[model samples]
Target: MSREFLPGQVIVYPYLWAWQHERGETEGRKTRSTSVVVAVRGANDGLTHLALLAITTQPPEPDRIALEVSDIECRRAGLSDFKRCWIVVDEYNYDVAERSWYIEPDEPALGRFSKAFMMRIAAAFGQASRKSGRRVNRTE
Candidate 1:
């Protein structure tokens, strides 16, 4: 079944980070709240391509690109439990939602980010991508 996805939506996912993939790991060690940055349905492939950003509680290092999540934004994204969080923009997990082995379509989205906030994220992602950001292909 095809699942509807929207940018800024928050969902639970086993997000494989680039570092883990570099170490030959194919799966994330645990499921966490992730932000859906891009979701596009391919006309020819009839598959939904997703670019998901990891929502991490760990503070970003000096060299990494990240956006700090405010308390209000966290609540809006269903992340009130976390003391703090940031959306890592330097890397993302790419997946084909229709053919995904990990995405659970039956599960409802945790919450969603406002369109305004999403615009900021999209812009940051664009910059990050241009700077040679990493991508972990979960569909592979």
Candidate 2:
């Protein structure tokens, strides 16, 4: 809650909390969720907020549009052992916490998507939003 979050940064948060509230289900315990920050801005109340897309090692569903991240990029973003990763572009959350991010090595916010890749993500998000009438939602 005290640190700043930037777009393109990879972060993990207490997704079990949201899952519990939204679906009343989790893996029988708290589990963290990883996402890539897409945007950051100050809100009316003067709080910093973030927009993010879910990241996963799992192969995305056929209906989902995803960007492939290389192993080097994955390591830079606090993920390792995976030679590749995917960032889902169809849906994302907005106005989430600016802090409480997690990394396995406790490294200094090392996970970040490259500027070029981030631009691609933004473009994809725009296309999907325009076609599907989807908008980023503030985290609950």
- Please state the error at residue 139 of candidate 1 in Å: 0.8
After superposition, which runs of candidate 1 have C-alpha atoms over 4 Å from their true positions? none
> Per-residue lDDT for 93-121 in model 2, tens only?
55545432332334346477778777887
Runs of candidate 2 with Cα error greater than 4 angstroms are 15-33, 98-110, 133-138
Q: Which candidate gets the maximum lDDT versus the true structure? A: 1
Error of 2 at 20 (Å): 9.8
RMSD of 2: 4.5
User: What TM-score, computed on C-alpha atoms, does each candidate reach?
Assistant: 0.97, 0.70
lDDT of 1 at 1: 60
Top candidate, metric TM-score: 1
Question: Pairs clashing in candidate 1?
Answer: none
Residue 69 accuracy (lDDT) in model 1: 90
Question: Given candidate 2, what's the lDDT at residue 70?
Answer: 79
lDDT of 1 by residue, 25-116 (tens): 99999999999999998999988999999999999999999999989899899999999999999999999988889899799889999898
Candidate 1 versus the native: TM-score?
0.97
